[model samples]
Target: MPHAEVDGVRIAYLDEGEGDPILLIHGFASNKQVNWQYPGWVDLLVKDGRRVIALDNRGHGESEKFHDPEAYGAPLMAEDARNLLDYLEIPQADVMGYSMGARIAAFLTLNHPDRVRRAIFSGLGYGMVAGVGDPEPIAVALETDRIQDIRDRTGRAFRAFADQTGSDRQALAACMRSSRQKISEDDVGRIERPVLVAVGTEDEIAGSPHKLADLIPHAEVLEIPGRDHMVAVGDKVHKQGVLAFLNNIDA
Candidate 1:
């Protein structure tokens, strides 16, 4: 429930545990607790001697909300993470993000490689290369009076999830309107640090983890078998794979 002022907005974040730092960025419509805490990520990582830092992207959770579409983008959100790191006086730390947060993590690594050590991108696959899908339907769904009014299945699911999270509908609609920036193949290739691309085998939203792994210079893929996008976040395999990845890295 801690807050940090970044770019004129008060961003809510949770800084917990001890030892080496790991910044956790949650997916769209999810906050630090729902995405990382409820899933036992904080406990698992903390048990492994890691300091966990997670934040609610603008327009979600306890953070300040904005109705302007221009206020939300991968770059701007990534900057919020960077500014949070600055606020904490963390010069460098391991970065991990899920779904939308993964895209934002990529931009953070690309723009401020000096501030990142290893990168973990979860709930993302070839979509990072294929481009973020259309935001119009999702935006419209968020604005609708009822989830049943959303014709698109994905849009309905997102809208319902946002509602369950008690998110600001207008802010989320604006976020959907402006969060379409995609990372290019060239940009992926430019990342020099070790990267882990983790995705569920049944996640249609995430294209292919292998496809994305092939693009990064030093990257590997971890597939959570028999899980989809929604269910994969709390998978035990994901937690183990990440712990092993972190353990194997030379500190």
Candidate 2:
């Protein structure tokens, strides 16, 4: 529940434990709890003696939710992470981002490579269409207010997360307008830190985010066999993949 004012926006983050610093960046429409805590990742990380800093980005969780597209720009988002690090007085640390978070992480690594000691990107995809996924089913879901429908279908647990960030039409529109960045394969290749790119095998975002890993010089790719983007974060297989990567860096 700690807040850090960075770049004129208030970011809510969990600053816990003591050891090598690791920043956890959640995805679009996801707060720290849903992405990390719900999946027991935050505990798993801190239990391993890592100093975990899990943040709620703008328009998500307890962070400021701005309607303006420009406020949520990718460059600005990356700067938010950098500013948080500055506020903590830490010069460098590991960064792990998922879904939309991964996109922002890529920019942070590209723009401020020196500040990142290592990086993790999951559910990565070059582009995203707000409602174009799954074709017919997605189209019907959109008609019935998919966000609410998802909550109703899945129960309050997941829907609450969607509502906490962007379960509404307006929020989704704002996310699509503001979240996309112009990172390319060339940009991916530029990160100097030890990198890990992972994606669920059945991810809805991109079929193969591991391709992104192949392009990055220091990246190791991980693909969880049967999980989708959403389930991947909670999957034991995904956890092991991340653990292995972090273990290598820790060594």
Candidate 3:
């Protein structure tokens, strides 16, 4: 139940284990539990002598909810992450984000490379640039209202969202709808630290994991065949890939 006050809101974070630090970021409409809990990522990283920080982004989990469209952008999300580290007195740490979290992690590396020692971004199923072009009008139509419509459209597939305790699903859906801001390819190119992008072979939303790796200079890509997004986070093969990446960084 630890919380960090950032941007006039309280952000929730789990600080566990000890040693070199690694922060885990979750995806859209997903809380830290939904995204990282099932994966055993916290235990996996801690077992490897790394402290894990699993954070609940604003509008998700126990964190504050901001319905303002501007509050949901990558810049705001990324800033919230750094702010938490600041509060915790953490100088620098490795960061790993999945799906939407990956997007913010990528931005964090680009914007504050000094704060992140290394990065592992998964569900790179699709590059941000590619996903930006996807149809958003459907989501935009329900930004301020149309709650049921948003749910009706994405509810089944993103059931974890529907299961949100209170304002989570609404706030998360608003965040997605507000992603009308243009993606900066340059920000992606500015990743100076070692990077790892991964995806399960079955991910459809983030399409072409290999292409994502190709775009990020010197980054490595690993595709876990036969595993979908959730499985990639929870499956043995995917966890091994993560450990391998972390080992390379420490090496």
Candidate 4:
């Protein structure tokens, strides 16, 4: 339940274990617990002699809520992550983010490369290069009281997940209406840090992990076979790939 004051908002985060730090960012509508703790990511990283720091993004979990769409863009959200690192006085750490979190992490890596030692982008793919999906339908779904009223399949799924997570519907609506930023091929090519692009083989939302890996200069791809977006979060293949990646970094 610890919180950090960052950029005029209180961000809830978890700091556990001991060793090099790894900042974990959860996906849209998902809190740190559901996305990281429940999936055993905290434990896995901690057991590997690494410290894990995860935050509940703005408008989600116990963090401060903002009804303003201007406050929820990827750049602003990435600043929240950076501010958390600053608050903790962490000079640099490995940053790992999933889904929406991955987009935020990408912004962080692009804007403040010095603060990140390595980057892990999970549940993200060509969407990083191609651009984000439309947000209007999803925004409407968050505002709708009835989940069934959301006609778009993606909107319905996201709305249902938001309900399941007990998120602030209005705040999430604002978030959905905010900016959807995409990294350019030149920008991706400029990143020199070792990067890992992990995605589920069956994740339609992510497009293709290989496509994204091809954009980054020093990046590798890890495909979690037979897993979709939701299921891939806790997949053994993901855990192993991350551990192997970190181990190689230490070597």
Candidate 5:
């Protein structure tokens, strides 16, 4: 485990293999290992000769945690990614992010276009612009001690996931409060890097992948058949589609 101090926060990360780098950003309540390593993403990409870099976002995993809502946002976290790249002395790398990580990646690509060669936004779609539902219930669920008391389906799921990951509920509640700033359609259209917007066919939370792809000038879509938001992270078709996208010469 390596640590990089950026924007006054210490972010834990794993940097492995050796080749062209691909930075991996995990979803909410997910650490690098849970989202990328356990899902075989690191192995798959590494075997394909890509140097993999996966980071624990500030409030999750072994990274620094903040209890104040003002301390978190996709743009701020995007800077953490950018500064980590600077710390590693890499000018730019292909970036991939899931769920909340996808939002962070979009901000990174938009704010620092020259620092990203290509990007993959998975587990998120039109939700990036239209919004991903209200965060209040999820944040409240995380703050509640008894899981059985959480009535909102999405909130309960997130609460369970936070507990399973041994996350700081208070910090995560704060993160849930502020990390989900939606990107404007105009801003999304400004991303010049080659981009892939991937989501599961059955995913109810991601809105529509096609709708999002339509907003970006250089974006493509991948629909992981028979998978939903949770299971789609490690789908074989999703992996294959990503590999094909990365290896495409004209992309």
Candidate 6:
């Protein structure tokens, strides 16, 4: 559980294994362990002979918490990821991100292409450009006194997840309010690195994997069968597809 002071926030991360590097970014309300370690992503990638680095984004996990909405945004958060790479002295690495993490990874790739060799967007697809619904309800739910009072289904689910993770609900609420900045279709199309857009077949929140893949010049799509947003992260199909996608890249 090493921590790096990037910009002004303290980002907590896990660095393991010892080959080519890959950086993992987690979703909203999730820490590095809950998103990558517990899900076997770190072990899977490490066993494949990769150096795995996963970070807890600002206001999540052990990272420094910021209650201000302005303190969070995909582009701003992407800076944290880039700074973490600089902190670790990794010139470039393959990057994978799930849900909110996917957005952060896209920004990292677009804003600092030199620092990312390949990119994987999981649990999010066309939603990257078309918008992933509204975050207001989710924010309200996180700030609500109790989950039982939440009426919106998506909001309730996010609130429940925040509670389950023992996250700082207020900080998460602020994050939800501002972190989802949609990337333009034009911007996504500009990414020159090889990309994989993987989303669950049943994921209503991720939009269409094909639609997103169609945007990136070198992008491909992987649809995790019989899985939805929440359960798709650790799915066998997802793990296999990602491994294959990573290995297929020529050194």
Per residue, candidate 6 scores C-alpha lDDT tens digits across 1-251 of: 89999987899999999999999999999999999999899999999999999999999999999999999998999999999999999999999999999999999999999999999999999999989999999999999997899999999999999999999999999999998899899999999999999999999999999999998999999999999999999999999999999988854
lDDT of each: 0.93, 0.74, 0.75, 0.92, 0.94, 0.95
Model 5, runs deviating above 4 Å: none
In angstroms, give how far residue 76 of model 3 lies from its true place: 0.9
Evaluated against the true structure, the overall lDDT of model 5 is 0.94
Per-residue lDDT tens digits for candidate 1, residues 1-251, read 88999879999999989999999999988999999999999999889898899999999999999999999999999999999999999999999999999999999999999999999999999899897578898899999997877899889999989988999999999998988688889988999999999999999897799999999989999999999999899999999999889999954
Which has the greatest TM-score?
Answer: 6
Q: List TM-scores for all candidates, in order.
A: 0.98, 0.85, 0.88, 0.98, 0.98, 0.99
**Regions more than 4 Å wrong, model 3:** 132-155, 164-167, 179-182
In model 3, the Cα lDDT at residue 164 comes to 47
lDDT of 4 by residue, 1-251 (tens): 89999979999999999999999999988999999999899999999999999999999999999999987988899999999999999999999999889989999999999999999999999888886688899989889888767789988988988989999999998988874677888888888889999999999888789988998989999999999987899999999999999999899
Model 2 has an lDDT value of 0.74
What TM-score should be assigned to candidate 1? 0.98
Query: What CA root-mean-square deviation does each model show from the true structure?
Result: 0.9, 4.3, 2.9, 0.9, 1.0, 0.7
Give the alpha carbon lDDT tens digit for every residue of 63-109 in model 5: 99999999999999999999999989989999999999999999999
Worst 10 residues of 2 by lDDT: 128-137
After superposition, which runs of candidate 4 have C-alpha atoms over 4 Å from their true positions? none
246: Cα error in model 5, Å = 0.2
Predicted candidate 2 versus true structure: per-residue lDDT over 1-251, tens digit per residue: 98988878899889888888999898866788889898898889889888999888887788877666667766788889999999999899889998778877878888999998899887774342122132223223323444555423323333444656454434434654667665666766777788887887777665456556667788787887888766788888778889899997678
Best of the two (1, 3) by TM-score: 1
lDDT tens digits by residue: candidate 3, 66-103: 77667788767888899888888888999998878888
Supply candidate 6's per-residue lDDT for 83: 97
> Of 4 and 5, which scores higher on lDDT?
5
Q: Model 4: which residue pairs collide?
A: none
